[model samples]
Every structure is written in structure tokens, then in C-alpha cells.
Target: MDETTLKENKINQQASTTEHEEFHTQYTTLNLGPTHPATHGIFQNILTMDGEIIIDSEQTCGYIHRAFEKIAERRPFYQITTLTDRLNYCSSPINNMGWHMTVEKLIGVEIPKRAQYMRVIIMELARISDHIVCNTVIGVDTGALTGFTYLFQWREKIYDIFEHICGARLTTNIGRIGGLERDFSPEVYKRINAFLAEFPKAFTEFCTLLERNRIFFDRTAKTGPISAERALNYGFTGPNLRAAGVDYDVRVADPYSSYEDFEFQIPIGVSGDTYDRFMVRQEEMWQSLKIIRQALDNMPQGKHFADVPEFYLPPKEDVYHNMEALIWHFKIVMGESDVPKGEVYHAVEGANGELGFYLVSDGGRTPYKLHFRRPCFIFYQAYPEMIRGGMLSDAIVTLSSLNVIAGELDA
Candidate 1:
């Protein structure tokens, strides 16, 4: 009785083990980026998927890394803006202006009120330009393309303003070390007014399309949510952090370029999800418009740049005609002027988040050392955590909402 019963029991247990092995699910590894359109940039993610769900993900940066910090060490202060241009090409003016303000801080140059107001207008325009790309792309990822096409035209109009300010459009090496290269021309004012009048209606229509749409809401509402605590822990700033119900804006916390003079609300959201991120950026665009209006109305009466002729290039006409102006222009452009021996850090509320520049000058034309606190680089570290346990599609929308510009991420 004992031998026959024991053999039968062991055979039953073996059958049970075989059945368990047969029914178990097999996981798949997928490469989601580094050239994929859904990724939006040169970023790669190795994802472990359980069917359509992402269980784990590892991000790979440096695919577009160009060693911007080391390059800054070699280039002069004036030349560094060109490098910043590539950092956040979506909002190149903000990068350009941030670098200019950093050098201005290091050299103790006080930017004039008029110049500051002009900067506010340009930076806010850039912020709007950036949000247009991000929010529209989020819609596109959710299978809504009409809004993207509708609002992208306004982004081009904003680029037109940039072209009028400086000759270039994208990657504009726009402002000078002390202030802007030139004041706003009458045509620039007309363009700004035209944009101010026309853009709001188009933006409102774009918002109407996705802000309350059932499909978009279902796709983005709870996807890739992070708490305020985790967002702060992950070093989030800008719309991403604000979406987590944290209202810490670099412009409000530490005002620069006369941001303190402007009165505007900082938009915040309760959930750090894709929808919240999109909404926060939408509201911020409105606030940017408000700030731009205030700056334009209260425009100060003065020169476009600061009084530091040593750093500011002389007028083009003066350079061609006057011998002294020619020498000064040559000296400034060639980085022949000596820089102060000091260290300074300056940050601006960039389109993505807080873009900081830490500069060390040892009485040299070029920076002794330079470091950029790129928000995309910092916040992209949290991508895996944010997308864990969510669907593969959700990851795409999440990345788009975060506006993780590849240039800034790999800079």
C-alpha cells in the first residue's frame, strides 16, 4: 500500500509542475528608441515588456552628446551662446539670453530696464514656441493630429519674430553679453501685435480639441503619474514639477532679467501625469502672454543695451566708419577683452525647466570651467520610474509631455 500510493503521489506532483511551466507567461525585451519617431529624439530605451505593458526600462543618453561644457571652456563668453543654442533649440532665445545673463552676472553688468523688457518679450515668445511643440506632440502621440497642424503655424509666427530680432530663426545666437544686439524695430512691434491678436484664438481652439477630449483624457490622465515628493526627489522643475503641485518657478523663486517687475501667476497642477503636464504648459502659455503684454505696455525709454562698451559690440555703421569703433568691435568679437576673475551661477526658467549656467572666470577671455544644469538631463533620469507599470503607448505620451529635448538631454 505505501509503495504504490507514494509513486502515484509523485507522478501527480510532476504533472502539476509540468502544467504550471506550460501556462507561465514569457516576457519580451524591446528597444523603443535612438531612431524611433515615438521617442522624439536620439534617446534609446531598453524596455522589458509583459505583453503591451512596460515592466522595466533603461534609458541610454549620449547618443547626441557633443561635450558642450568642455567646448564652453575653449570658446569665449560671447561665443558660448552658440553652444547653448543647440542645448534647447526649441527655445534657443532662452538659452542665448540665459548665457548672456550668466556672463553679465560674472562681469557685474547691470542690464537696462528697456533691454530687460525686450528680453522678457523674447523669452516669453520662446516659451510659447516650446510649449506649442510639446503640447501639440502630446496630442499627436494620442492620435490627434489636427491640433498639431493648427497650432504649429503660430510657432512659425513666433519664429518670424525671432528672425526680425536676429537674422536667424532656429538656433538663434540672439542677445549680447550685456543686453540685446538691437532694439525692437517698428516692424518687430507690428509683428508682435499681430501675433498677440491672432495666436490666442488659435491656441484656444487647440486647447478645446484635447483639453477635455475623452480619448486624450483616457490616454493621458493617469499615465506616468509621479507624486510631488518623487518629482522633487528626481530634481524636476518647470512644468513637470509644477504638474506635481509644486509651484517652484526659477523666475518666481529667484528672479532674473527683471522678472520681478512682471506680475503673472505660476501655473500648477495636482497630478504629475501627461495630462497635467500638458495643462500646466497650456496655462503657462497664457501667463507668458500676460507677461509679454505687461512688458510691452510698460516698455522703458532707454538704449537697447547696457553701458558696458567693452563687452557690447559697437554699432555696425560705427564699426565701418569710426576707427575707435572698429578697434572696439574687433577686440570684443575676438575675445581680446579680459574677463573678471570670479565665479558666478545664473539660472533662467527655460521652456523645459530650470536651465542654469555655472561659470568660472580666471581673468581669462574664455571660461576656466563651465557647467550647464540642463533640466532635460536631470529629469530624463526619472523616465524609467515614471513609465514603469504603464503601457508602451503611455511612455511615448509621457516623454512627449515632459518635453525632454534631445539636445538639452545630451548636452
Candidate 2:
């Protein structure tokens, strides 16, 4: 063929490609939510689409902003654990542990073996709960309300355990300065065992119901695939990063609270698509249950708290009977506890991702600066990239897939 013939063919191919754009010119764009049921929390996502296909997406934040960092800076070192609870409300226990561990590092305080084991057990349970909610919500967004009812029931059981341990359920500040507020009680033990015995069937039913459904697979399988490399560059961790085929779990890479002792697999995805994320999280729930069971069995017999009475508060009996104890309690509560002058970063395997506390102290009760390395913030950043070529409807599924809680993202 002549050069002019080749030029004409190239021009024709370009025209054909432009003519067949997934989002057609006639269709208009629609913004999904900074406040939609599918969005879980306060998060605004701007979606441009033609019919069902989404051409572009933009996620907006600052809706649930609490200025947690600024508040942390003003609070005492020990008091910051409460702030951590607000980071990922679904996984407050892990966030509480992360904040404590960072302060523990600065003070060179060693958490007891049982405390470490307990932290692992509780945090893993939170992880499983987090994944279950994300998956169930994704299912609900895709018109599978049955999945929501079944999974939410299981989630209620988990919350019941949390509420039993602490007075609150969702925002559980279960940790003390060096250990737990109290030891796991017999009642707490009984409820956990009862739930454990029954949870497997519910979990299996959840899988059998949705995992094999043709419509669910078709909606998710090849949609919103982000590459492992892109995921890393975007600074994603936890389940989101795992779905991208990078087996970089913080629990394994940087084990805190004796997580290295546990035996488990880090499930990785091949396509980094929505299907892989769903499967990866499902498998993780199984693994988390295993870890919880092991921790319960291997719980060491020792003190539930550390001997640092000055840093930690005195027991209730001592407070009532002893003048020294009363004086000490008054001092600690009044921001008179002298925290060491140092800066530390502690990262925990939160339900969402890496819930870290970057704290700087200046030998005072209050922190000089406090920064949180929120997982939802990083995971949600991949929104536009994941949905750039997918449909607008897929945004609902994709938002659930990312499992972003707006409180953490906005904070």
C-alpha cells in the first residue's frame, strides 16, 4: 500500500476510537456522595458519566473533620488514646493500641506477654468485623440487602463483646497507659466463646450466598483494578494494599504486640480488581478468627497491668483507702504526669489500614505535636484511578470496596 493509504487508515482508526468512548457525549455526570448510604460515612464523590459508564471521578473530604491532630497536641500523652478511638471508629481497639504503643516506645515500657496477646486477639477481631462490614455494605450497594442483614447480625455480636469489655461499643477505649483498663472477665469470655462457636456457619453462609452469585461477580470481577505499583506509590496499606498483590502487612513487616508469634497467611490478589479485594478480605476474616482462637487459648497468667502506678492510675480500692493513692490519682488526672521528652511513631494494623500515631513530647503532660497516619486517607486516594474507566454505578461498589470511614479520612 502507498504511504497516503497508510495515513488514511491511521486517521480512520483514531476517529473510530474517539467515536466509541465509553461515556458518550449525550450523557451527563452525577456526583454520588459525601452523604449516600453507599458511602458508609461523610464522603463526597464527584462522578462524570455517560449512561452507566463513568469517565471521571473525584472524591471530596473535610465533611467529618474533627481536627484530631490538633486536639491530640493539646491533650496529655496518656489522654491521646481516647483520640485514637476516633481515627477508625469501627476498629477503635487497634487505634487505641497504636497510640499506646507509640507512647510506650518513648517511655521504654514493656507490655506484658498476655497484654500483647490480648491486643492481637482484640485487634484481629476488629479486623474481621471491619472486613465483614465493608463486604456486606458492598453487597447492599449492589442490591443484596440479605447480605447486610446476615453480616450485620454477626457484627452486632462483635460489638456486644466490645461493649461488655468497655461501657461503649463502637468507640472502645479498652487500653490503659501500659496495659488494659481491666482484665477480660468470665462473662466476656463466655460471650466470646458462644459467638465463636456460631460465627463460622454465618460466615460460610455469607460466602456461599454472595461469592458464587453470577450478578455479583459480573459487577465486580474486572472492575476498578488498581495496580500493585500504583497502590504502593499511593501509600495504601492493610486490606486495600493486600488486594493490590503486595503482601506487605504491617503485622508481618513490622510486628508490634507479639504479632510475629501468630501463624497466618497474607492473602494477595492477582488482578487487584474488586473481586480480588472481596476474596482477600473474606479469607482474612477466616484468618483473623484463627488468630483470635489461638490468643484465647495461649493467654498467659500474669498481671493485666504494668507496675507503673505513676503513669497509670491507682486501683479503686487504693483510691478509697489510701491518701497517697488519692493524691496520685488527682495528680495524674490534672495533667501533672510527666511524659518523657521524645518523638515516636507507632503503627498498628487497624481495621482500615495503618492507623499510626506520630507524637512529639516536650517533657510535659501535653504533646507538642500529634499526627495520625490514617489508612482511609490513603485508600480513598485511589478512587479516581480505580473508577476512571468503569461505570458510575460501580462507584457504589468501589466505595464499599475501599472501606473508607469518613471520620478517619476527614480527620
Candidate 3:
């Protein structure tokens, strides 16, 4: 009776377990993108989902890997700005300035106070431009297109300022090694003043459209949350880290380009959710405006570029009219100038976060080794963690809030 009863019980248990296994839910694998517009970049995300909620995710980058660091190694120091232009194109000026500062530090060139102030203004303008892209894209992902279309005009105005300063707008190799190519012209000042006066009201309206709107708040408030501790562990910076309640701003922690001379508050959020990220960037734009105003108001009177004739080029008029100036210009442009042998690291509070340049020179025209500390690349590794347990829609908004530029990721 014991052996027969035990055999029967085992069979019954096996049948019960088989039935339970059949009833268990199965997860589906979904690929978000390498070319999908919703991804906002050329990187791919492979997601495991139960219905519409994500269970697990794997990210694949390098679809557009341009090997910017390698390119930088081959190019002369002056020509490297073109490569940086594509790193965080939304804020190319910050990348451009950061590289210039790294070279300046390595060469022991003292940047003029006026040049520093000018750099501050341009960098802040680029910051605003970068934040605008992030925050507005967040709106669009949440099905709010009005804010994006409206606020983008202001970004164009910022570009106009860039165009007036240099000849180019987007991928502006805007500044020279020691300082800017030239001082601000009257037209540039007029455009800047106009932008300052007009943008605040429009930006305020853009904020109002999404900041408290019930739909925007609900779509983003608790979605894609990361704790302050987790964000730091993942190496977050800029608005993303600030949204997680970290006040570690490169501009304030290690001031460069005269950032310390200005007055502004570092805005932070509590939950590090999508809403917090959005709000943090919203407040940051205001702070950028404040810095730009201060830089303009306290504009020091002096030469725009430092007295580093080896690096900074002479005036076009001089190059055209004077034989010596023409010869010097040809030599500098032709990579005939010598660079110091050294290693240097410089970081700027880039639009996404800390945009850093680690440079190694061997007394040559090109960098021996070069690396960029792209914030987008660092924080994007946390994307899967942020979007796990949330809806597929949440993934899009979370990425938008992080503002992970594809260019930075591949570079």
C-alpha cells in the first residue's frame, strides 16, 4: 500500500506542476531601435516585455561610431574642434570650448579675463540650447508638440547669435585656442539683447504649458525614477544628476571660463523621475539666462584673444596686407607650430553633464592620445535600469529626459 500510494502521489504532483507551468505568462522580446526615431539616437535597445511593461533591457551602441578620439589623434590641435562639433552637436560650443581649454591648460596659456567672460556667455547660450532640445523632446514624447514647435524658435535665435559671432551656426568651430576669434560686434550684441528680452517670456510660457499640466505631470511624474545613489553610481552629471538631488556641477565645483564671477543657483530635484529631470532642466535654463546677463553686464574691456600668437591667428586684414602676418598665418594653419609634451584633463559643465577632455601631447602638432568624457555615454548605460518595470512609452520619455545624444554615445 505504501509503494503504490507513493507512486500515485508523485504522478499527481507532476501533473499539477505541468499545468501550472502552462498557465505562466510568456515575455516577448522587442527591439526599440538602431534607427527608430523614438530612440532619439542611432543606438538600439532590446527589451523583454510582459504585454506593454518592460521586464528587462539590453542596449547596443556604436551604429554611428565615428572614432572621434582616434580622429583627434591624427588631426592638429586647431583642427580638432571640427571633430568635437559632432560630439554634442546640440551644445557644440561647450565641446569646442572644453577642448580649447584642455589645450590651453597643457600649453600653459593664460586665457584673458575678457575671453573668459565671452566664453561663459557662449557656453551658457549653448547650455540653454541643449536644455531646450532635451525638455522639448520630452514634451513631444508625451504627445505635447505645441511646446516643442514654439520654443524651438528661441533656439534658432540662439543660433543666430552663434552665426553673428562666427560664420557658422551648428557645428561652429567658434573659438580659437587662447580665446574667441573676435570680440562681439554691435549686431551680435543687438541680437543677444533682443534674445534676452524676448526669450524669458516665451520660455515661461513653454514651462507653463508642461510644468503643471495634468497630462504632462501624469505621463512623467513617477515614470523612470532613479534614486540619487543609483544615479551617482552610474556617473550621471548635468541636469540628469541634478534631478536626482546631486549638486555636483562642474561649473561651480571647478569653475572655468569665469563661471565663478557670475551669480546663479544650481537647481535640483528630489525623486530623479522623468518629471524631476524635466523640471531641473526648466530651472537650469533660467539660471543660464542669469549667468549670460551677468557676463554681459560685467564685460571686461580688453583683447578678445590672449597674447598667444603661436596659437591664436592674427587678423585677416593683417594676413592679407602684411607679408610677415601672412607667413605666420600660413605656418599656424599648416600645423607648423609645436605643441608641448604633457598630459592634461579639463572638464566643463556641458549641456548633458560634465563634458571632459583628457589630452596627451608629445611635443607634436597632433594629440598623442585623446579621450572625451561624454556624459551621454556615461549615463546611457543606466537606461535599462531606469526603464525597467515601466511601460514602453516610459522608456521614450526617460531617454528624452536624460538627453543622451547619439553622437556622444558613438564617439
CA-lDDT, candidates in order: 0.91, 0.82, 0.90
What lDDT tens digits, residue by residue, belong to model 2 across residues 1-411?
A: 363354445444544678654544453446577577667788876665657877656566898788888887788777777777887887788888887888888888997998888778778878878888889888887889998898898888999988887777888887777888888889889988987899999989999989999999999998888889999899988878888898988899999998888888888888888888899899999999888888898889998777776678898899999999998888878878777899898888787677777878888778898888888887788888888877777777887888888778877
Clash count for candidate 3 is: 0
Question: Where does candidate 3 stray beyond 4 Å?
Answer: 1-20
Error of 1 at 292 (Å): 0.8
Clashing pairs in 2: 33-44, 34-43, 34-44
TM-score of candidate 1 to 2 decimals:
0.94
TM-score of each: 0.94, 0.92, 0.94
- In angstroms, the error of model 1 at 59 is 0.7
Q: Which candidate comes out best when scored by lDDT?
A: 1
